[model samples]
Every structure is written in C-alpha cells, then in structure tokens.
Target: MGNQLHASAIRWLSHVPFPTTLVWLPETVGADEEALLLAAPFLGESPDGLSLCRDPLGKPYPARRGYPVPWLHISNTHDGGQRLLLAAKHENLVGVGLDVVHLPRLRSPHKDRAYLHRLAARFMEPTEYERFQCAARQDDEEALRRRVAAHFSLMEAASKALGTGLKVGAFMGHSASLPLSALGALQLEPSVQLFFDDHAQTRLATLNAQRWEAYWGSDDTYLVSAVFLFDNEQINKLPLDEQTPFMSY
Candidate 1:
C-alpha cells in the first residue's frame, strides 16, 4: 500500500489521450485467464498477456509483477465466489471503482426484506429507507430488488472511486454524522447522477438487457455499476473494445 508505483502501468501514459476501459472476469484460484483474453483486445499487437502486480494499497495494475503503474487505478469485488477485475487509467485522474451483483438471487431466501431492511437501517438515511420501502412495495418484487441492489452497487463503486469508501465527505458536510461506509449510511441526496458530467460515465447498467448484449455477448443475470472520476479534457469514456499505444507523458 505504499505509494511507490509500478512502471508498466506508467507506459500507458503519453501526451495523447487514452480512453478509460474496464473488463470483468470470474475469479480463479490460479491466474485469471478470462481477464487476460479481454485485455488482449486492449493491449494491441504482441502483448505479453497482461501480467499484474499489486501496490501496497493492494490495488492490482496490469504490469510486470513488482513495478506498479502510477496511472492505473483498480478496484474489484467478489460475488458468489466469482471475482471481478476492474482497471481504469487516465492522465492524472482521481480514482475509479467497480462493482457487480447477481440479480436473480433477489428472490433467494437469504435476501429477504427483513435482512435488506436491517441492512438499510444501518447504512441508509431515513429518506433512503422510505424510498426502499416504496420500491419494495412493487408487485414485481424481483425487479424492485434488482433496482435497489443496483443502486447499492453503484454507491459502493462511487464510494471507492472517491477514495472514501465509507467516510465523511466534503459534499456530505455535517448531515452525515457517521462515516457513510455502510449502504444505509449513504446520503444519496440530490443523487448519484450529480457526480458525473454525463450518464454513461457512471451507470446502473442493465446486465440482461439488449443494449449491452453486444458488449457482454449475451443476456446474463447480473448488474454492473461503475464510477469513473476523471477530467473531461484528460480522458474520454472508453468503448468496449479499444487499443491505445503507450507514449511518454
């Protein structure tokens, strides 16, 4: 977790712009091959297959094992034994975060309303709790649960991208008395949209929807939420498949 950075990640930085991109792979006990395949599309020409190294912060960066990249910001989450790998690189950008959750499981006994309600009370503001109740009241219980789960996932990503993951922020000021680390504690006032200049930059994207079918290959039962923090002039939202050469900054 010391700030000393790796070199390969730095190689991606140059005077020209490099779009911020992300990839997700199921977790593996050994090396994660699925992530490597996705990376091939982005690395262009003879990539040594996407080696990774972790910094003192335990952040993974695509680089030779020991040298950490200074520009790449990474965050990941685990769901049902599956691992998600998210990496974002921008010229002097702040941070990036990613989260994934399975949708169909909302109907599972484990995620009953009582559990969700308790979790909401611990981390949500009163308004947030009320909103959840309203959402949960819908006859389409599964869809409602999915929406709530997606919202929570996005907030988690945003919290990580902000480098506060669950802490008091200047935006929250005094109203958020406790560190907003838990889902219920988040004061998602004016809204999560305000954090981004555009909609796609941060999204509660549908996983089993047609819009993303091309990107993911087919409809799957899940939702992905990501938060990207960058200076507009410094980077553009990366498309699903893109390749940029490394150059000097």
Candidate 2:
C-alpha cells in the first residue's frame, strides 16, 4: 500500500548483507496470480515465458530460466491477499536463494517434531537428529527453526545453483549437524561456513556453499531465504554500501 508498509517488510529482512528492496506493481497489489506473474520479469522475460502445456492433465507449464548464480526471489502477502515480490542479486557469481512461509501453516506442535524429523532425515546425520531431538525436548523452538531452515534453505540454494531441482535429492542424502546457539554452526562441505542470526522475531542463516553464500530468514509470520554467489576478487571488491542497511525498500 504505502512506503511505510514496504519499509516494514524490508526491516524484517535486515539480516541480509546486501542492498535489498521490494517492488510492488499495480497488478500485483492484491492478487496471488499477478504476483507470480511478476516473477517472470525478474527472470529477464515477459510474464508469459512458457505456454501452458497439457500432459493430458491440462496442467499449465510456465517457462522459467535457471539462475546462473546466487539470487533470491521472495513474496509477501497481506490478510487481503495483496502481495509484494522481491528479486535480489549479489555482485559475485555467488548469489542468494530465498523462501517465505506463513507460520500459521506449519503443523501443530505435537506433529511438528515428526515433520521436522522427516525433513531432517532427508539431509541430517544420526547425531544431528539426536541433537535436534534434544532441542525439541527442551522446547527450544528457536533452535529447531534454525536447524530446519538451515538444512532446507541450503538444499534449495544448492539446487538452484546446479540448475537441478530437488530431483537430485542431495538434501535427503546428505547429513548436517547444526548447533543451537543464535550463531548456529554447521560443519558443511569443505570451505563452507554457516551462520545464524535472529532479529525482529526472525531466524536468518547464511551458508558459504562452495563459491557462493546462501541465506535463509524466517519468523513467526514468514520465511525468507536467498543465495549469494561471489568470487574471491569480487568478494573483496563488494561495495561498502551493500552492507549498510537502507531505510527504504
């Protein structure tokens, strides 16, 4: 609706270390379908990139481009269904991957453990599970959220970078052990580091995966995740302004 509302959303994602902003289009002001259409523009194409195809099921297939580096796409909707979509890019080949989830949609507490287990089992080792179980027993919601978000966000970012969807199922095959502190720690593939930050009621994580860094942000209301790609020289040349949080979206 107004700049104030947009500013609030950007503040929610202040943990990201990039110059990020959200754009609201007239058509997407209150429609989910229109919001999805806006995603096409960020892909460097028109809204109707792909023709709707039928596998005999009348299913619609929209043509989408694979992100070559780290980048993030995020959408925020209000009670009336109005939405705002954001596309953020990093200067390096290392880009960002982002995801947002409405907290109310998460399963009930009794079922949350099971859900977390199933998702974690797909990517975590036995010891990691044990630690997560302990955290759950202690009712450590923050710790649990960080663990889950870190695991899945990294998986998604890796998938985007490789131009392969979750079809590879690497997330289900690999294992990760994440710590419970705000600075959650995970021993990932060589040269990779994972950092967790909680702010404004959100949990944000950063993964230095290969030559890129992937970040995940979530809160009681939504989850925002992203991936950033960068090379050694570019990383060193990153403008200082990119790190300064802006007051506008």
TM of each candidate vs. truth: 0.56, 0.49
- Expressed as tens digits, the lDDT of each residue in 1-249 for candidate 2 is 234443432444455455444444433333434544544444443655422221122212233442222243332323223244444444443333334444444446664666766766655545555555654565455556555755555545434332222333334322232222222215332323544334201212232333555555444554444444444443434354454332212
lDDT of 2 at 51: 25
Q: Candidate 2 local accuracy as lDDT?
A: 0.41
The per-residue C-alpha lDDT of model 1 at residue 90 equals: 55
What is candidate 1's lDDT per residue for 1-249, written digit by digit as tens?
111122232222222234433444346664343553354344341235356655443434556445545566566665655555555455545566666676666657787766666755665556666666765675264555554665566666665554444444566523222254333312222334322212223322211111110011001355555555554333354543453432111
Error of 2 at 113 (Å): 3.0
Best by lDDT: 1
Flag regions of model 1 displaced more than 4 Å: 1-22, 31-50, 109-115, 130-139, 163-220, 231-249
* Residue 161 miss distance in model 1 (angstroms): 2.2
Best by TM-score: 1
